[model samples]
Target: MDPTGTVAIRARLAQAAAVIVTITMLAGTADLALTDVFVGGEGGHAVYRIPSIIRTTSGRLLAFAEARGSQSDNGSNDVVVRSSDDAGTTWGAMRTVCDEPGRSLNNPCAVNLTSGPHAGRILLMFQSYPTGKGEGSVATGFDGPYTCRTLVMHSDDRGETWSTPRDVSRQVKRPAPVTSVATGPGIGIQLVSGSHAGRVVMPFNEGPAGKWRVYAAYSDDGGDEWKLGEPAPEDNAGHGNEVQMAERADGSLLLVARQFGGGGRRKSAVSTDGGASWSTLQAVPDLVDPSCMGGLIATSSVGAPCLVCTGPASAKDRTNGQAWISTDGGATWPRALPIYPGSFAYSVPVVLSDSRVGILFERDSTSKISFITLELPSNAAPAAKTP
Candidate 1:
């Protein structure tokens, strides 16, 4: 659609009094409605950061973030979430899904099982650390007060209630020498095709903070038993950290990651064996990175295979939040649209029921976690097959 047509859609929605806060309309993109789902210093938390969003099987939108007691990364933090039944038009009360008295429960990565006995269950995985220990101070072991541990929880009732967290550090994290692990800080993906169909793949990063390496922790029996996968081949471009994954229509997986202190360009890899191994990493020429995590989602809108990415468009700062559309199965991003003009970081995107895309992101220097939805222009043809 044209720019004028996009504006008309916004005008009609406003006339009908939709329960949304219309932010701004960019050229050639549909109404970009904004909703502040989590506010800083509210609900007894000092700040909110690291937004991860997903739509459940029951069609409920669950937005998750770390509710920190202080602005520091090592401050007392809890994994909290809020749900919206109307596609983010309105949100329910905030609830804490994981917490500890003197520990930090961070990185809320979630995925929904679609088959087997535990089908429809939502699995949430996060990392736990001592209250005063950040990535640099965390030890390189599988068990200790200073070591990082991976935990998993589930909610069978769609964000209303959750089960007790189960420790899976042994299954997911490697021992001594690989420390300071993070589970996505974004959402996970489930394969819909290929020999390993219905597999759950969650992006992960390990090793010291600056020397970080990316891998995948996966489950085959609908999240029944978790196991670690081989790490991606090291690239001379940069060290990978805080990653996200999306499966292509041809069944291969594409992993995008934030480069830890390299040039301002995102790194990517491909996996043909269902996340067990990956090809050598390469720098994404189009995505401008600021050493911050970004969001990614794959969709087949109108039968065209495409990928939507959300991140800071500027190479120097975390400002100028924007969304880029990749119709060629993530080979390149030729189209871009603005999401926020300033102070945006750590975002995740989900495909709404109406074929529109919803991005939940942190803005205003971690004071607010907001959401926005936009319609993708349907112009590209279906993706060609790859071997």
Candidate 2:
């Protein structure tokens, strides 16, 4: 059906239901219509940075970022968060999630653990730096005296209150003085079929080369006693800066990575034996990323596992960001649609259960963040053209 016809049918249906219920259905519809459409950063602060967004099982949209302080050196950055109960229509006032005494926190990644022991918990992973220090110069890749630690903060009752930050870095035996390039607990996923089934898997980067690695730590009896898994193969020298893993329909796991080295292209590797043994690094054709972090989601929609990744379309820059879809696992991807034309840094795209796409990315070079929601075109086909 045509777009106009679809809109008219939906409106008529809503109105008819309102009349049947004898309530102000039309008014509610009008209010929804008046809700500010998702225009990216239309109503957000002008100077937000390092934005991360996630959707809850109840459909609440939560966005978190580092609200930069004044230029005159005001101590540290503030970790702020906002929520949208009605999809992406409107957002509540920004609230400080973490205000450290003498430290700065940034690069927030959140996940709603729907399975395992902590089923309804919301886990937030971010990096914390010591007092009076900015995230180390990118040239050094966070190798400095400031000391950055990976922390996990969780909320059991939604966003109302959070448990004290739990240091997961202890799981990894760090060298004396702890100066060997440990920066992030960036993104986490739940393992489905591995020996460490139901364990929380977090992908982090270390060393000047930024060799990205995946660490598995499971809390068998809730978040009380946690065990760490051995390092998986195929992560040597590859900067797993922003790692994403998804369990395929066949119970296998597919891990996607963005290379931080030169060329800025996306790479993929498969773990048939549940992340223990992985295939060699192979380039994912048609997906280009400029060493920037992107988001990936695996869903069982078309009778098979479908994957979606949002990253740069340009070969050498992160200015042109696009969304690519894969149908036959991660073997190949073909469909590419532009999400933003100009330079947007490290946008994370999330797929909701209803198939809608939510992306939060940096607007310009000025540390501003924008949020956008798109209803993916149903007629769009996967680039692989298989499943």
Candidate 3:
């Protein structure tokens, strides 16, 4: 009697243990809610890095990144994109947006024109490098194949197809002391108010490697032509690099950039003339950056004026991905919530259809590009509207 009873007790205990293990497994994965939009080493590439994302007017999400031949930035790289119909819940196949045989096309900056004849058209701006060349090797000039070139392409059908790449280097690039120029590795903005309303503004950075500076390349008649703005005034504190822009409620533009020499804090500047010229660069004290590309955008919801930025929270390393919210038109980032606590680099944030902020970022060591959605605080500011 005792033997049979003891055997039955052991069986019950074994069942209980299995149930506990199952619960633990579910618990571990319950909070891992990120979607891998572009995985590393997929689609005939060695790595996928420098993510840029946007939500089209047709209610589709497009994520773009650099598909590289090797992990190095100087290698052969192509700009690729993937679209999602259900708002990042699912993704379509990877489509190569732009590719140059033996050359490298990087920084897939995208923006959707919200007004005028090309209101729904999407424009992508990127920098084309010479064969196997990178930022350090490229020189500043208008020469087609020897110097770096800035190009643009458009898609009217919500990223289904792209037009031929047009060279805008002569229009958007500065002549001297600028050895290399790169487009917003994130996204651009279209002005909605004031004298410059409906202007498509693209953020760009010119570099001699260490002394990088930020500026804007804008088009008023839609994406047909582009013009360069004066570079942000540089100082001893920091030099701007890899930047993004947001429109304020008062119709001004705010640009946030990565600080090259100054290390810890993000650099910011403002433009009242629709990015024609920018104010002096200032450090965003609250946005602790590690010299990596960050995402900045104005929320498109209905409430107060809100701006959201995504990047690493650490000042020393590219870890701790977090969302910094500013209710006062990016005047101050008082609220921050963690997106990922480890290994986040080069992120692009977009406003989703359900009023959530979606951040597409590169994981540690330039491995993959992933997407995660974060909810805005209930008391946070709403969308900004020009007066």
Root-mean-square deviation of every model = 4.6, 8.3, 9.5
Q: Distance (Å) between predicted and true CA of 56, model 1?
A: 0.9
For lDDT, the strongest prediction is 1
Q: Which residue ranges in model 1 land beyond 4 Å of their true spot?
A: 1-29, 379-387
Residue 318's lDDT within candidate 1 is 88
Per-residue CA lDDT of model 1 for 249-293, tens digit only, reads: 889999999987668888999999999999988888878888889
List the candidates ranked by lDDT, beginning with the highest.
1, 3, 2
Candidate 3 per-residue lDDT, tens place, 77-163, comes to 899999988867678899998888868888889998889879999999998888777788787688857688888999999999999
Estimate TM-scores for all models.
0.91, 0.74, 0.88
Question: On TM-score, who's better, 1 or 2?
Answer: 1
Model 2, stretches more than 4 Å misplaced?
1-46, 70-75, 132-146, 172-186, 191-197, 209-238, 272-279, 301-304, 381-387
Judged by lDDT against the true structure, how good is candidate 2? Answer: 0.56
Highest-TM-score candidate: 1
Instruction: Report how far off residue 80 is in candidate 2 (Å).
Output: 1.8
Candidate 2 TM-score over all chains jointly: 0.74
Poorest stretch of ten by lDDT in candidate 2 = 18-27
